[model samples]
Target: MATESFLREIGGKSVVEQIVDNVTNAIINGELKPGDKIPTENELCTSMGVGRNSVREAIKILEAYGVLTIKRAEGTFVKQGFDSKMLYPVLYGIILQKDSANQIIELRKVIDVGILQLAIDKLELESLHKAEQAMQKLEQKLAAPAVDINAIFEADTAFHMVLVAITQNALLEGICSYVDQITKKSRLKAIEKFINDKATERFLLMHRDMLRVVKEKDRAKINEVVEKHYQYWEQVTC
Candidate 1:
């Protein structure tokens, strides 16, 4: 390949951006494949005729975005795919700033209800069994005289997570995990305030409704039940 001179005469911008763009375009154009080693820092310095520091800095920035992955003994390589770890810290930052809980919960209501509708179309026997198991566990936990806060939270998280898991979408599951982390404190607070025998029983009944609709493959029923159930949390969080 005839390498373009990324450091040529231009306005006084640094070569780092050109280097990053050239490399990124190469990866996007399939010139680079997953596990393909990036040019060594020394090699990039020589090829781009720039300082080693410039190349090193660009690589570091790209690696942070999930465009590249570095293995300790092995050299850097194009990433297999974008990973959620890239966005989780950013999501957590947004949550910590405490500006967007309602926005996030609203987004959750939209996405989660959509996932349940999809699960209705694609529900497998195994997924229903998993949901049932989660539900039964919730029942057992709720039967205790003094419910464990963490246990109830985990069961509730698992119950909703299963909805995304059964949809068989890795990205959706990753997103669910991210959102769960963002709202963990607020959700726990809501649970502390709103959870009781009545609330737990209502949730169990909602889960049963979801399972029944999924088992029957009724899209309308599944959508209705899921939206109603999830709206309960949105109201609480709001």
Candidate 2:
């Protein structure tokens, strides 16, 4: 495949940025693809009419973003499949934005609803069993004589993770993982509030509702259940 079209000369200021844009565009346009080796540093410099330093910097940035992987002595290649590192750029972007908390809530709702729909369509008995076990563990944690907030948090995370796993879609799971990290603090706050308000059963019941929705394959109730699930989270975060 001819590389000249996609690797055209990148001119003007912010040479490194331009180079990065060029490579990303190629990937988006299918000129480049996952696992495909990118041009050598010298080739990039020559093709983009940029300095070797600029090309090297662009390559390093892409590698850090998980867009490109550098293998020993083999050269840089477009990364194949999902990389947790890829989430960092997006994670930081959202974190740094003003008034991002509410936006994150909305984002979570959208992702959860979509995930629930997918899980319902692809439901399996084993996955349903795991979700049940997760709920049981959560209940046991809540029912302890001295409720452990940390334990509850872990159990809560596990239950939701099992829901995401039910979809059997790796990309959705990865995105959900990203959302989990971003919302970690707010979710803990919400859980703490539920405990302080003596609403542990309510919390458990919300999760039970999720399991019930999944078990019944009730697509109509997904939005309602997800909204209820994030109630305390919205209250505390907002």
Q: Which runs of model 1 end up more than 4 angstroms from their true locations?
A: 1-31, 46-50, 72-74, 89-98
| lDDT scores in order | 0.74, 0.87
Q: Model 1: per-residue lDDT, tens digit, 115-135?
A: 877787778888888988988
Please report, as a residue range, the 10-residue window in candidate 2 with the lowest summed lDDT.
Answer: 1-10
- Candidate 2 has a TM-score of 0.95
Worst 10 residues of 1 by lDDT: 1-10
Per-residue C-alpha lDDT of model 2 across residues 40-114, encoded as one tens digit per residue = 887877777789888889989999988999999898899998787777888788878998998888888999899
Clashes of each: 0, 0
Model number with the top lDDT: 2
Best by TM-score: 2
* lDDT score, candidate 1, position 211: 69
Cα displacement (Å) at residue 159, model 2: 0.7
**Root-mean-square deviation per candidate:** 3.7, 1.5
Structural similarity to truth (TM-score) of each candidate: 0.77, 0.95
